[model samples]
Target: MKYPVLFSPIKIGTMEVRNRYVVPPMATGLARADGSPTEGHVAYWAARAKGGYGLLIVEAAAIDPLGKGSPWDEPGIWDDKFIPAWKKVTEEVHKYGAKIAIQLHHAGRQTTHDKIGGQPVAPSPIPCPVEREMPRELTTEEVYDLIEKFGDAARRARDAGFDAVEVHGAHGYLIAQFMSPYSNKRVDEFGGDFMGRMKFPVEIVKNIRRKVGNGYPIIFRLSGDERVPGGRDINDSRLVARVMEEAGVDAIHVSAGVYASTQYIIAPAAVPPGFNVYASEQIKKVVNIPVIAVGRINDPLLAEDILESGKADSVALGRESLADPELPNKVAAGLTEEISPCIGCMQACAGYLFDSTKSNISCLVNPFTGREGELKVEKAEKSKNVMVVGGGPGGLEAAWVAAKRGHKVTLYEKENVLGGQYRIGAIPPTKQDILKAIRYYITMGKKYGVEYKMGVEVTDDLIMKENPDVVILATGGVPLVPNIKGIDNPKFAKAVDILEGKKEAGTNVLIVGGGMVGVETADFLGEHYHNVTIVEMLPEIAKDEQAAVKFFLMERLNKYGVKAITNATVREFLDDGVVYEKGGKEEKLTGFDTIVLAMGAKAYNPLEEKIKGKVSEVYVIGDAIEPRKTLEAIEEAARVAVKI
Candidate 1:
């Protein structure tokens, strides 16, 4: 009722979505090694459906197993054997009155030889700038085979009871490779002119229509702008929309970016929200069919506004859905504040997909993302007195869930604010979204009856006086103070203090440590017209940061005239500047200003050693266990909370 247009039913060909909330297909890497749908994958989609999403466009399925997109295992529709397993997902989604669609995809040259078990195949023998591996050019007959494969996948999807099928002609995949001049340079019919390049997808669409008949919805996911030189631009995107319409496709779901423009694909917090809506609007001008605008449409009000202004017919929530599956239901119920916001950290959703250690899709804020069935907060059989130390994300999550499960939970924080270092970390540019997660924790804590004791240091005496059944020490971390010459000087301040606005730097600032904190500190200072230089002992700065997020951050820092000297060791801190050694020579960089230290953090567990053995049930989490990102912190705390 609040967002009438956003909540309104809309038709995509023969299928009617219950609402305009579309969960766009995001790669979860949830399928088996053989490319079959797993129970976890089915549960992941079912949770979103039950949460009140109108339609779910499942993550890209390989039409050919050899065309697998990412190195991670993904679903496949190349074989008939996958149909029955996929049907479980559709049946579960349909039970909640939500229609589901499958995305037919191929990696093309976007992947590496190790991923697809060969030199990767594309319309042309072009190597993706990011992947750097030259792909084998597809033969004329092979191209025709792939077209039929797309048709076969669509027919299988319909047999599996899916309401629709999406041709993933976006994100620099196989279809996108054929459509773009950047990669397509063949002398064959599939390349050369715009229409020739368009012929591949056009024929694929026509083939799908012939196989699925005229009734089933066929949505073509188009990348409005590839964001790379000589790639598919908005002009080409509009023409593709018009041609796809003529080819009998039902809708256009416009996303942006290629493999090179990875920033736009996931759109980190640095990128403005709903920035790609302009592309969708441009394509919508040339097409009568529906156009769904995606890329960073996080807020529900923004989705409503986009629809109200006629910029897009439907709004897609990709990573936002992972952060909170119940977002649509919460918005429909007018409890917008309760909706868990995606901070766009890329710490989990995009982070996991790219990280070699992590293969499944998850969220930094919401641990229940890919593990939907695993991380449920069930009511306890017996209630107990739970005392949680520290008010950070991990501690807040632990206390909130414990209270929700009928435990009498009391949380204590040394600082008055609850978010701890994460809250302070939000001070940098494009990082203010981090506070949303912290605020959500605080809000949910109140809703779940969590008692808070602010600025109260829980000591051993206090713990003994009010003995709790369980004690969770999430005391967080202290800034790392490495043993360097003249390191104990009273003149320099920590990066945390600078972020907290407790300390102001001079015009010229020298920062020690070139990790995320150090780089962001430089950006924070550079924004205020300060000349900043970072010295790191490592080969690069912020090497641990998410690649795409780091790319944009580095770009902003460069604009601010921030200088970084890598493989340099800071030997001594003086009143004027720091003495550093680079290339085996000691050099003194003279500067008339503040000597700030952004030397990362170390685990602060002073109380853990003292109280661990004393408390019958004691657990330490978050930075107290080891200084890390919010991803590990929240997960560690949740794992402990469920057990308690």
Candidate 2:
């Protein structure tokens, strides 16, 4: 279990990281709309630090008043009011014996007027691709002002009790826009040649060094490749990394892509693990400063190999950290099975943060993400026996939390095994990572002394016989079968039936629903067996999903050649075909041997009235509250468990 060079301590300027496991700067958009930190922000970072990360760098906080990017929640250091709030975060990390840093940023052309209360001003008058807003080019005097602003932000970060400061010069932001020829099309001294464009970022770093002095660590996040055809590439990154090192940067964090090249930044699943390690290796070879590599560094062994091979000094983990903040700690303690794995499904964290600003940070599998403090399971006043109904993610999490709080907990599941719906998701070729989460909960429940009763249905009489103080109904939802002509026919099958081996799909299959579940089922079938056609009543598949997750799902479905038919209703199921209407035209498609129903699920709330006043405390969570993603179910169950 010896970690390769990943566990080696390395010094960056005056700061020494206990290990090479660095939690890279990733924006969760958990701040208040007015650039203040929220409790969610505190819980998010504290979890990672406590989980044993060597250094946790906060997300990009703008240095200038007008440089804030999105209209949603993102923190800033532009004002003095932010100091005490940031100090709260720093103190929480210090308590865990982990060093923390803040990434200082300027969005430049990437800034949106809605967030900053003014139009964005960049180095040139070029219009942004996504924003479509023309920016007023900055004057030389304004450029100098920007440099000083960055310096002041660095000084404030140190004063705020941060161990280090990171200048966000990557991801096609302000300094990156200046460094990239694709955005900085200016002819002045700050433009024209590569050195001219590089001048601004170097000057910003130099000024930051002058302000923070020689003792403080200052790392530069560099976009190794813009990934846009003619934009910033490795050559440009190398040149800039050397300049940053010469300008007194203590480290270079190599990353890839921008908003323009979406796939590169996010690094789709098709991309290999440690995909961006090449960029960091290139930067590390040329610069004296330490280089950190990110992008799909999910496997601990793989990360260790990258460090041992000298690809970079540190492995920067983002989604992995979000998936399990205690991943490093678990690995260090040789409890690898205890780690909750992040499956690279960005639905809960980045997906919700970008799509819905109001929702707090979440994990697809981990329910206690943002509500860490409020959701802690404290020992019960008196040891009361608890009975949890069902064995899904919600029920399992509730049972585990209650047991941790020293409650005598017992769980009952009608099914022969645990992981209700999650077991189906686990079997799909693309969803192996989800199984890790299910296993983690099961293992934790056993560790916490919870009694598990599988294949046992809990009725009112059964619950009365148990005589528990608290009854948690996590009875999972059932699929809502639409009253279509062929839905109940022998030729048709429910998606769950196919998933659970109750029914088998033929070579040619017609999936009746196009929502997230249906679409995923289609993708699964199409990946292993061809001839899968998805028909939906809605115009778009996965209509309830977040934009980013839907986008990736759509891409995968297309890649698998899963034909999607929307705005269509199923008419009848035939022995050799399916009848559907598209645009008021009746179309009978032949040659499909099977039809799978995947419309959606209905919440099973059978115990509402029965458990309403029967016990001192009654809680309904997961699918019983609402049929939603595993993320919502787990989060709801955890929140309620802590309160109970």
Error of 1 at 93 (Å): 0.8
Residue-wise C-alpha lDDT for candidate 2, range 341-364, written one tens digit per residue:
777666776676566434566677
Model 1 weakest 10-residue run by lDDT: 606-615
The digit string of per-residue lDDT tens for model 1 on 1-644 reads 49999889999999999999999998897888899999887789999999999999999999997888775787899999999999999999999999999999999998877777877999888789989988999999999999999999999999999999999999999999999999999878998898899999999999999999999999999899999999989998999999999999999999999989988988999999999999999998999999999989988889999999999999999999999999999999988888788998898888899888986999999997898768788999999999999999999999988888889999999887789988988998899998889889988899999999999988988988888899999999999999988889888989989888798888889888899899888888888899998889999998988988898899988899888889898888788878889999999877658888888888988777777777789999989988888789999988888888
In model 2, the Cα lDDT at residue 506 comes to 85
The 10-residue segment of model 2 with minimum total lDDT is 262-271
What's model 2's TM-score? 0.94
**Which residue pairs in candidate 1 have backbone atoms (N, alpha carbon, C) closer than 3 angstroms, thus clashing?**
none
In the order shown, the candidates' Cα RMSDs to the true structure are 1.0, 2.3
Candidate 2: lDDT over CA atoms?
0.83
| Candidate 2: Cα lDDT at 438 | 82
